[model samples]
Target: MSISRRTVLGGLAAAPALAALAACGGSGGGGTTEITYGYIPDFNGASLLAIADDRGLWEENGLKATLQTFTNGPLQIQALGTGDLDFGYIGPGAMWLPASGKAKVLTVNGVGQADRVIAQPGIDSLEALAGKKVAIPEGTSGDMIVQLALQSAGMSLEDVEKVAMDPSTVVSAFSSGQVDAAGIWYPMIDNIKQQVPDLVELAQNSDFADVMQFPNVMVTSATYPEENEATTLAVLKVLRAAMDVRAEDLDTTVELTAKLTQQDAEAVAADASNGQYYTAAELDALVGDGTVETWLTAMNEYFEENGKIEGETVAPADYFTFDLFTEAGK
Candidate 1:
């Protein structure tokens, strides 16, 4: 479904105060640059942006930024395609959409191994899941985890009885023994553990870390970078500053994000703990060493092989740029 800005903002009465867009343009006569940014609504999704807002980094950087929340990355990608948003944060799953030439990635915000292949107590190994029924939310990172784990065990989805289930219902089905195992992600992982105390986590994304890497990214419209180089750099600097704040004081960071997202502090903290974030220097190193590129390319290749991509598959260089990110840190 196509989500319009009005439709999205209709129910977001509790969201933080948004800055007014500059009438003249992004910036003029020493006035702050105005930018509309789209972001995901979860903790991992909102942390950096929330922190930036809470810390006055946007204003400090001479920006009048407005933050808008999207239910998911694909919707954000849709908005970007139409030029409704200048920039946005998106998950690895929606990263493939940018290959269609709608948006371009700026930098990696996080590398969170939040997906896992969990099994029943007796089902101790991935190999043992060969004939067992496995619950999975198809087309998610959780599903990809299942595929990679089975591949590691010299098996495939064909070897198992695939039970496609919604993420919200997976725990109930697994607890009732309706499925022998489940390809799941966190928050759900925590809940399932409470219900099935003996749940066996056969594999998580970290287990396949060497071959697979899926990092959440900050992105902009495909032409935003070329048209607004200084503004983009300013935004990156603010994000980098937020990263420093996040690394230094996680408690405050979590609190601000919880408030912005209107989620429970404990749940937000749990989600934050499950993620892997990089500092400005670390991000630079990853970009310089081709680590981030390799990860993005791996993600692209996986989606391409699965026929998830709609158009011609694009390489990392085609959609990602770190030139401004590097300059921002300086």
Candidate 2:
């Protein structure tokens, strides 16, 4: 089944009006498309996009991209739906948007296994966190780590005393012994670890990799892929080039990521080595061999089972514009 804005927004009946507005925005001189790209300026989430912008990769690839920083993925999705953003570098927690036909995941940038569930040494396993105060950024990938780990331990968020706090605050609270455990991501995890010397890592995304894939992904509005195929492919090429830049120079990439995200170079350095960054060929192989489909299918199923996605299940093909990546590889 094809998933497009048309399908969710009443098919062709509503396309013309939205298309008319979308067309008026992305035009640029010299045969370039001026697009507004959204990204979360948190270290890992913003790394590649930051690298691309820092190195002028967007302009180099023939696009005039106006980089926009979003506080979170939901806001980016909201912008995409409203035609404010042409593309977004977002986290996996917002994958539900594509599954619900609100957006389309263009490419899985990399495995952001940076999120972790940590406890104050005594609380050893995920199950041990039951009835303990656990700070979590509600509705984030970090929260996903907590819930998925708890599910494996036969517990749920209800079993824990949930403390809803921002990531930085979670680090402070967990460090000060106010929360027994906290759902957080690096470099905040790194920050809390320094203070709480014997912090026990209860779980991380890699531990649940067999059941779900939590990766940083590139997404656009449901109609963007259908209407701007060439521009989308150009963006992918720019991302691939950015990955090459990142691989060729670790020191520079770290510095750029730290600078762009305004994070500490040390913390960024510590967290940088935590996840896998796939090259274009690697991404092409993942999609070609069905690994991409399998991972996303698992992710969608997990979201559906948790009531995070409503209505009928969205097949991987419905939400993924993987063909664009394949074309970009060529």
Candidate 3:
């Protein structure tokens, strides 16, 4: 299932000439590939692309990456399909749609504890969420985490009143007593606690243990990588190096995320300690073998079981392109 620029333009197949028009404007114009890097302003590795840009690593690597912030991952995904965003530091669950066909995965940049499941004063457990309304962004990693978290309580999304909203709104909705609970991402999780001191902590995504993984990955348009291999490799090199820099300097990383997300640096640093970061060797191994495919397969099935994705389940390998990562490593 190949997705061309015409397919990405969405129903513009009738205008075949537009494809030629886009190519002339998109990097074929004889300059560094002007990359619009999309990211959710969460205090996680996904947002670290902003740090890479802020530190001028992208430029240092011979590419120009423009940082575009999003309120949530789904919006970021939408931009990817329409070609509004050429590159993204996106989450695994949302990465599924593009990984399915629309784009190529450079690598799973980092896995972290980004999402949070918080309840109102009276709702304290996953069981309490069964009949009550729960706010979360549909088709996102946080959505998957919450779905699996419900299973541990012997329930699924069917048992609850699921209100799909943007992560930007979920926190406000949960804090203002509009929803019983919200499965939102970080910084928002930190924001909620500060705004509503009485909000109850139902579960963290990590509480589900091995049943869930909220991974952030780098992705490019399916054709983009093949057409601009050198530029793609440059992007990956900068990101992998950026992760190493992040590990060596926590306070600066937190400050970068805080500045980008507009949250307090201390709050970002304090709550940021919970998620896992991948090592270079660990990332290489995951990309080199079937481990990521295995995770994506599990994620796909989880989505299908929860009715988040329609039709027969797609294979995980279709959603990724490991050769790019392998090339970057070389």
Which candidate should be chosen as best, given TM-score against the real structure? 1
The regions of model 3 sitting more than 4 angstroms off are 1-33, 45-47, 54-56, 82-84, 121-124, 176-178, 194-198, 259-263, 310-314
Error of 3 at 162 (Å): 3.3
lDDT of each: 0.78, 0.74, 0.65
lDDT tens digits, residue span 225-249, model 2: 8898889888887777777777678
Which residue pairs come into collision in candidate 1?
Answer: 26-33
TM-score of each: 0.89, 0.85, 0.77
For candidate 3, give the lDDT: 0.65
Superposition error at 261 for model 2 (Å): 3.3
TM-score-wise, the better of 1 and 3 is: 1
Query: lDDT, candidate 3, residue 137?
Result: 72
After superposition, the stretches of candidate 2 with alpha carbons farther than 4 Å from their true spots are 1-30, 54-56
Better structure of 2 and 3 per lDDT: 2
Candidate 1: residue 238 lDDT (0-100): 84
Worst ten in a row by lDDT for model 3: 13-22
Worst 10 residues of 2 by lDDT: 1-10
Pick out the ten consecutive residues of candidate 1 with the lowest summed lDDT. 1-10
lDDT of 1 by residue, 64-98 (tens): 78888776676676777788788887776676777
Residue pairs with colliding backbones in model 3 are 99-319, 113-275
